[model samples]
Target: MNKFLLVLLFSTAMLQAQTVVEPDSTGVVKSNDSLVVQKTIMRDTLKPFKRYKAEGVSAVVGEYVILDSDIDKAYVEMQSQGMSIEDITRCQLMGKLMEDKLYAHQAKQDSIMVPDAEINGMIDQQLQYMISELGSEEKVAAYYRKDNIADLRKDLFEANKSIKLASLMQQKVIEKVEVTPEEVRTFFFSIPEDERPVFSAEIEIAQIVVDPKITKQAIDEVKARLNAIRADIIDNGTSFSTKAVLYSKDPGSNSKGGLYTGVKRDSPWAKEFKDQAFSLLEGEISEPFETEFGWHLLYVEKIRGQEVDVRHILLFPEVSQKSIDEAQKKIEDLKKQIEAGEITFAEAARKNSDDKETRNNGGQLVNPISFDTRFDLTKMDPTLSQQVYNLKEGEVSEVFTDRDRTGKSSLKILTVTKKYDEHQADYSKDYERIKKLALREKQIKVINKWQNEKIKDTYISINQDYQDCDFAGDWLKK
Candidate 1:
């Protein structure tokens, strides 16, 4: 028989064996033997299970039915993420899907609520990512085998929501899992001497930035321009969205008519922006206000209890070329003073650096990914790596022009404060990294135990064909 016909025959076989058995007061099913207990739990869990009328149902995990096609789709997703799937097998995919379904099902049972707005935001981000990767909305829909972008979004929303639930459930299981210092040492020493990981060549860098001054006249001009646009919208009934599209300097929202949704008090927005947004009633626009990025006029589109949706137009004051030249000269002169031993580099940075994030910390740059002072040379940003490639410890680089994320230009000079050559990891020197590894291992064990226990309590039935595959968990048991 063909695979499809075989699946149909199995589905019919399963339908012919429906039986319901209730558990006792101790939450254990009464049965003749161990095998019978397992069978009874399966039947009890599937009391109201809907019978599949067609083929291709690979397994049933609690309330979810995994289909044969899901494995293929998963493989496609892994490929899109640049993962090598040559060593992976269909059985592995089936196990992973079962785990996700189990987590998602248990999350709902535990009343782990994922907000609709959060899921919708994730869907929007995913849609944008897919569109960017595939060239357009039309291409994304076609790639996903959907008739239109709406259909694609519907699918993505459901998929992303389930994935988020699974992730949250897993996090809850391991949130408190930790390892002490003793455990960290034990974990590191447990590895054989020859098997210890090698430390990569790394450097710790610091910098000083000087921002060009924006004159008061320039600031007033920007505020006046924003006020004029706001007045036109309120007085002449011109579209605020049209004005945002034409004038807003914030690239993130300008193209979308400055629309932002799900703005809560705790959301990571500028204090000024949120203050202005929350102060307005629906359809009310605010006076021009200043934020670190620029001046903005906020229009409250809607208020949904704790969350508000707002639209805005941003305008930043212009910096004159003379001001830019002056900033560059200031940084250059500071470099000379530091080189001549008149003022220490760190002292100069602490006193004069315009980069607020590092100025208070004496301009010391921390690697964001590692949250440490050292950065691995191979993994560092190409531009920065080249700048510091030849510099020795305590040597400062020539002043260079840099642009912030907002495209604001600044002059910067970097100093390599420390350097490390590749070497075997030392216990004391690598303690923090080793501690992280130990903690992660502890979390993994906790999650594995949780999964094993949940698998036993939850209802899961694998297809006879896939039952022979060796799985990490006792999934064959109820």
Candidate 2:
């Protein structure tokens, strides 16, 4: 916790690219602090930071330098992490700061202005993620020296500005690059034979998803029923909890009287419901609203920072057999059109599919785990996987009754457009995989080229302390 130890930890972490941003911590070290500098480096290496023990600057890059205190403080923190200063770490820290200042310089020249509101929202998102990762807001507060997360908003302003500008510069550098299938094959074959990755059994699935339609009359009836329940709670002093326990159909929350706790702002729940829930003042009851489940009335119970707890009464619309048959019939017709060569499956999906997520992507069911347009048979639903297992590639299954992810009963037709067996990747069978790999390689190459070009144009300087140390890039050389 002391300055000397903190510097050692940071000094070691610099080897791993860890503590470059918290420059203020360096101010705690003695101007001539040689203890950590001596400790971090072996007796052979020149003590670049130790000379600053009594001086104004440790190392300079263009107009920027790691101050004596900052560099030495980093040395102590590096020691704490069981690391020591070396040419690589010293270069990395200096490189990181130089890159940051470069972005800062260019962003100022461009007169870029990322609004405070946007920056604050990003800060909140970061804090929320940290809170989730660290186990509590209190822990995050302790880490950041804030009594509450809100205090962090203004404090991270400069960091956010640098982040935004760097992002903008990166986008400008790598916009509009595209890769083709041949490029994909080349990229796959270029991999070293010994390092080639093997792949698992996977499938590419497609479907025509139909929503069991809820007629307008059924929707109105559900809404009317929810409104009456809300009236009883608001005007008659009835408890929201009692009505939720008795009427809510959501199995997950009904046992708890439909109360959801520790709900973060960016939850994966339906956007409309989450937005309305967060919009309400505490003790306010929302009017009847519909989500994927059905109609609902929500009452905000508590709000804490970016998290919320809410109680709701949920009701499903009465879906008639006629509506179900109509959905099935329409899908049957769509299937016939595809079979008759009147429309492609992808065209039909784009124009008429009910599932929005896959509709835009031509109905291919992408594996969320690997981000592949495939799924492993072992991981798939037993019943559905068995039904799909016997089918050959390019074969479409008969229309079958199934429930969508939202648990709505509907009819769908499945297609296994592509299939891959368990093996090391081959260019012939894994073009999708190759395309992604090649595209990323191209993007990375483009970014590196952009960075080198920018570094060449920028005014740069390094203090004599680090002038002779071998750094990774020509970052310091004009």
Candidate 3:
């Protein structure tokens, strides 16, 4: 049997029948079956058997009772690690389940539904996150004993959807919650000054960027070279991987025989790269193509659902000194115009900047920490930070060299747009911030109320074993 199928079956069996018994109340049954307890059992059964154990007395909702197998497993695992299971069990598991039950009940009451699109989106996101952490989907699948991500997607999707729905319900319940100016001040005062989070002093900056222009003829020449190479590989019966290893300029994957583990559309590779990879059928080779990274001959190896694996040989066209000199002179001329007031910095950026992301925003650089125009000079690029550290507001930086994430070097200039010194936060300075906090508090209350109502009405049943554990909400008497 497939490992994935086994997990799914276990989950279904665990949730199919569950009973809830209220603690400290006799002959008081609210509902007969508890979804919360059933779900918990499913999670426990799916975990590795070596770590399996039961923790805390169960809680009865209506007709359903939920159990904490993970907590039990943790207790037993800790015992194996030389900790006292009694102390750990007595202190944690039961309380935790009570909290989870309250939240899950609230989620159902608020009608927090996870749409199919949301589930699929989350699955993709998880897949990408796993790839980043494990280096590839193949490794992750091997570790989990699954054939592929699709086999695991359904279970992951359901679990994630349930958690998301619960979170949404919490938000809805707390929508009107708030902590006022006084509350903020009190909370701030309660914390020790030494422990307070220090706000970085920052400056706002802006810039104009340009790429050294590549002529159509130069691009065509590079593509023609790649085309020749691809033709040789196809006509000579040479393996694609061998050719890529010998000729590909993509330093990251070339050594691995130009093999790219499957990548999603958003997997940090350029859109052009992904588009070209997906366009080719498995085993099909693409003609030479030119992108920002120069020219490439791509070979699509396999298509796995939404992911594609490909190999490519890349060639970077060398930039001539004349081209660099020309670009530098143009930038210098633009700076002179700004200084002479022939064109305002904003106007110049709008008209000539190559940085599409920020040029339209008046070339103002965003603070990495706050994402606002404001930033602490200390947290900026070491070289650029040093320049801004010495400049007064409104000063334009001298021409400096920098490289982007792709390691492409370029010449650029920066202008300091705004500066803010450190100061204590207050209502006047942070009303919008305070309001958001207050609103979250309100939402929590609403969710709590909704949960109480749902538990009172939903069908729940706890097993006889959990009839005596104290629950936070009135699950048995409702």
Candidate 4:
């Protein structure tokens, strides 16, 4: 995934707000001003009439503007996504919107603009990711009610630009803040052992996967079938999407009429899928081509710059029952041999295990979080998590099936490589983690100091209503 996309997807919680309200009543408000006030509450509701007298209608108007627009929208969206809106308040929304607007304005004022090259690079990254997620541009466009992928690309690019700019600004701030080793160590020592993160025991695993080969005859047969389908599509004037929904074997995309979304050029499916899709002109249908998944019949619906909306029907060659039985039998035989002391598990895994990721590393599983060959019981996959909890060190597990990161299922045998019981964090073991925490604290202090001193020097004015609203930062005071 592109770093910007990752931030956009996960970093919404980090946006901070700085709001300023009006101090006194009745002044002419300017349309060009960045901040505006609207009344949300009745004037009679406020206590201490003198304070209300000072602030007047601007305070009420400011509150109303924030509530009606930003707060209400956020609440509705959150509720639509199954979140409770009861806890959300207008104040929170106002704070967030104000912060967002402030940062956006600052970026523009500072000339923090992404160049065309950067935009193109980001667009490519986003497109590939969307392709992988939605399986193809055709599916994406269909989902978004777009006529083609080009339209989808334009929308995605615009949506992602705001995300990218915000990230760029945040990165500039974070990069300048450094954490020293000594500070890291000291911070680690300060945290209570009970609160320290427990290191998970993980494993390093590899696999040497051998997909059941599809013969040339099978490929030709599938291709011939696809060609016939394409001919029918042309002659009958049937939509490619209708055909894909009926015939495509890619279950993930087939249900969505063979459209995919958020695809970028550098994604996993980008190279092979994109090359084939982009090669064809609009409304052109192609003969079957082989990809890792299977053989595919593709139809190009539209193209936008480097992005293409293409529908595809996939057909994976059937693996013979005999072949599957043979593979299983071989695994069973290997297990027997290991049990009978013919060879060590590590040696057997190195020689015979099909898993490339874990085989070379003696078939030990690694923790995804720590990226280490140690297992923390809590961090293990739920099924594996339960099974591993009961096993002792050096125990071999029953042959079981599991899916890889890409959701491809495979049969495997897990061995207990290492185990660490729950334990308190210590300076000796957790110094680096602690140091990072301390450094971040120090960085925040630096940022706060800068904000306090610099905000006064900058041009800032809050509407009269918000003048009394307490803000954590000194920008309000200015």
lDDT of each: 0.72, 0.64, 0.59, 0.53
Each candidate structure's TM-score, on Cα atoms with residue i matched to residue i, is 0.67, 0.52, 0.63, 0.64
Candidate 3 residue-wise lDDT at 141: 68
Residues 1-478, candidate 4, lDDT per residue (tens digit)?
3333243223222322122111111111111111211222111122221110221222121112222323333343233234444443444444444444344444665678865544545455444445656566677567555699677656545433433454455445556787777777766655554555554444333222222334567667777888888889889998888888888877656876776543335433635676777678888887768776667877776675655666788766655556556666766676777778887778878887776766787666666444556555555668776555666666666666665432444556655655555545556665654555466566556645654554565555555555555444553654
In terms of TM-score, the best-performing candidate is 1
Question: Taking the tens digit of each residue's C-alpha lDDT, what string does model 1 give over 1-478?
Answer: 3333343333332212111122232222232110111121122111211221233778888887777655655555444445455555666656666777788889999999888766665444445445545655678677656698768666656665666677678778867888888999998888768767677899999999998999998999998898899889989999998998898987767887887655666555678888987888899999989988778899999897877878899888999888988998999999999999999889999999988889888899989656789999989998899889999999999998887656777889999999999887789998987786667667656766888888888888888867776665678883
**Model 3 — which ten-residue stretch has the worst lDDT?**
20-29
Candidate 2, residues 312-336: lDDT per residue as tens digits?
8888888898998888889999989
Ranking by TM-score: 1, 4, 3, 2
lDDT of 1 at 326: 92
RMSD of each: 13.3, 12.8, 13.2, 11.9
RMSD of 3: 13.2
What would the TM-score be for candidate 3 when compared with the true structure? 0.63
